[model samples]
Target chain A: MSDVTAGALESYLTGRLAADVSVSDLHEHVEGWSRDTVSFTARWNEEGEQRERRLVVRAESDAQIEGDSAAEGNDVETEFRTMAAAEDTSVPVPETYWYEGDRSVLGGRFFVVGHLPGDAPVVWDREQRQDLYRAWDEREANEGDGKADGRAKGGSENDGGSLPSQFVDAAAGIHTLDAEDVSALADCPPDAVVERELDRWVGRYRASTVRPEPAVEECIRWFRSNPPEIPETTLVHGDFRIGNILVNEGELTGVLDWELARIGDPLYDLGYASTYYFAGKLIEPIERPELACSLLDREWFYDEYERRSGRVVDRERVRYWRAFSAFVMMTIGLAGVHRFRTGETDDVRAAWFQYIVPGLIEDMLAIVREDRL
Target chain B: MPYLEPAAVLRRFSRFALEEIRPAIDGEERFVRGQVGSMASTLRFLAGELDASERAVTTQENALHEALDGVEHTLDDHDAAATAVREALADARDTLDGTDDEAGSRIRGTRERETTLLEACDDVLARVEANLDDETARAVRRPLYDFLDARLDAQLRTLGRRNESGDGSP
Candidate 1:
């Protein structure tokens, strides 16, 4: 069944811990679509010591397993191994404990991680947007208040408790990681980055689309014919955004959702992050929509990322990936719609995705046309 | 006929769900509340769409035909790529013509017609880009781009401002 029960979890933990255990305060996070995330306190006794630890379980839901989200190379084990590898990096991922593969335990494979503090901000929420905007304002004030090094130099400590610098830091941390170190990630050759990504998303689009989207098809054609030059390949946290970053009192605590993480062009993440389709454009009241991820100034972000990663920011290549990012978003939307239409998922949000299709198509068309000149 | 219209009923129920049922549920029931809110908005949008769907369908059909006209004009008489495009278009038009007598198949027919026209447009653009010069290719793509814009405008108009929050993350 879709619902993971406390009893099932307790039984599994008891067996794994080799001691009697009780699971309580189980709370399911309501936001995400792909995984079923449950946070709870598990009490057990080991070596005559009663212990209590708060933990989070990330499991593949039926929708994730059977729906279009079953994209190749993305699975619970991959996510588990990816996080385990990143534990040695600067990225603030949740500390992973163990991976469970036996389906009889929780109906599917899941992994446990230490429950980290912080709420994942919903970027579309007006209050969250205001919070990020205030962070930007505070950082500006600090920068002007004789903290030039803070803004100019760029570091987590000097970022004035705002998320922009930390956001860049997290992205840089991921991009700079040795791809070979992450043994679970698929090998994406430097030469085939653009070709592979285009083929993957375009193939998914063709398979899952409910109708013929000429705009999307045009984008696919354009992208296929005009593949961007890959500068270098690195580990890309494919869904890098403010929404995926956990924030507590204006500080980024953990980067959540690594299912989309992979080995690809690092610039792809930058392009995905900078899409207005995913940022300030969602908030009707935000007057400044140029902030990358609705947090960092676009140019500032590029400059900061370049400075941190020691990689030159190729604005032209970024532009190509930005346009391709629209296609990625459109393909994902179509996938959700396809899953819904095919009766694979009953989630109303999946059906609701059709609402965003036109806007994405408009973005793709506008970008290619304006940028072509 | 009933005194209350179906759209009006849907809107009223949507309001009831958002304002009445949602508030009555405990605040801790965030998932349930979110679902209720989504259902309300979806029903409200559906109510509006019920009235506008026919018009939207007609507009889309017109746009498809216009795009197909531009596609046919751009194709060459003897080129293999152009032949492929013509074959796709002819097959779609034939299917549409065959289904013209069935009133129930109107929407499906329009959608199938749209699929064929759009695929042909893509094929033509690909062939033109490969065969023709940059300047000529741009000239050929201009009208098709216009049709795409019009079709998208009709879609946006139909969808309105609902879910303006943009795309969701996985």
Candidate 2:
């Protein structure tokens, strides 16, 4: 188990499926930071019939930072189970097939889910590609690319267009899920939602600082004095944004990361989604300067969200949470810079966070000022 | 108005953290077992410092509010005093233009009061400047710093103008 030996995965998958199986095209997927993700093709002969399938392996790592994964009461098992449970729901989660929580199998908790084929919606390196933009435009224009049957018939390139509508529909579906059904998730008491979020992030900010920031002190006081009231309790995808999701041909094949998924004030998710508008990748109309538009114009997505959910969003509350989210981003980004300065991770991505933190602060202040006016 | 001693408040908080919290939880489970074991202790130290800094900001905000309140209270007095000074200066100019007499004496009295009001405004401005530190004023720091700087500049210009007009005492 020092490495992902082929024998180990084959043995594990065979045990879970109760069939003799062989894994081929064994390769690792290089997208995650909290967990080691691997993908492979599986083949088996059953009753003299040939069968083949593509699968993804998700394994937890001990070295990950706390916020990169869920902080409390949730872990890899919970994520796997949540994805498995959502298979029948309108949410477009990958279909989870096997979960192995005992550490003996792969040195840590791990699971396997069906691997749907598609280009991820947010590609960090090749973000300048026009074809990708065109594909996104086409998908957003269509509700979401069609079902897998349509995908198979039309082929991978022509297959997905219904993704945007599907993603929005999936989010609405998740919001509508009964709290009783997801009782394993601890709910924030109605009154303490904002306080809990503030405390959680304040702890993160406090824990992650390597250098003294006088401005951050003022930000904390201002944030606490003006806590926004929660409009309603709903499930929050703590890291919901364009980059965290996967899409193919404008269809959302799967919701990718669940490490930070939780039950909390729904506006947190809305605010989190708004973070994408400033991600330096998702600037809309395809040609406008990313910085030209005010953050208010980005409210189109939220407006659509409100219209779809039939809930009159508290604009002030959303604005406050959005500012809170930006502050959280600054804290986390600064933390990444600290880690790099302290020799935690050698990856260059850690340093990139520093360049983004100040811009995020400026954006947060601008958002707060605009809302106040 | 000077803000209450924020630096002193911060010092007290830091002392309490070092004396009380540090020794008590030095070897707790989470503290010892986490990746950054002793780093947690360092965070506690930083938190102590942050508490002090926060107290300072609160103190500064309170002082600014108080100063603005004082300005409001003296608004009528300031206007009346300034008007009387201006009237005396005008009367002195008229006396100088015509014959020196009891009217000129009356002008001098008004001019003296005007100088006193101007002196009071200058003293208040000086205290405000002394109370403010551009770097450490965290709450409304930028605007307050600008306001104080601009006020000082404006006062200096007014003093220069009065001197040129021969209305300012030697």
Candidate 2 Cα misplacement greater than 4 A, ranges:
A62-74, A123-163, A276-278, A281-297, A370-373, B1-170
Give residue A88's lDDT in candidate 2 (0 to 100): 53
Tens-place lDDT digits, model 1, residues A1-373: 2557889989888888999999999898988877888999999998999999999998888866555466833899999999888888888999999998887778778999999899877667768777777777776777678553355336454343357778888888898775798989888788898888888888888888787676776777778778777867888888888888899877799998888888988988898888876674521224456777778877888998899788988987887888888778878878888888988877777787777677777767777876332
TM-scores for every predicted model: 0.86, 0.61
How do the candidates score on chain B by TM-score?
Answer: 0.67, 0.22
Residue A51 displacement (Å), model 2 = 2.0
Clash count for candidate 2 is: 9
Tell me candidate 2's interface RMSD: 22.3
lDDT of 2 by residue, A303-333 (tens): 6557667777787776677778778777767
Model 1 interface root-mean-square deviation: 6.5
lDDT for each candidate structure: 0.75, 0.53
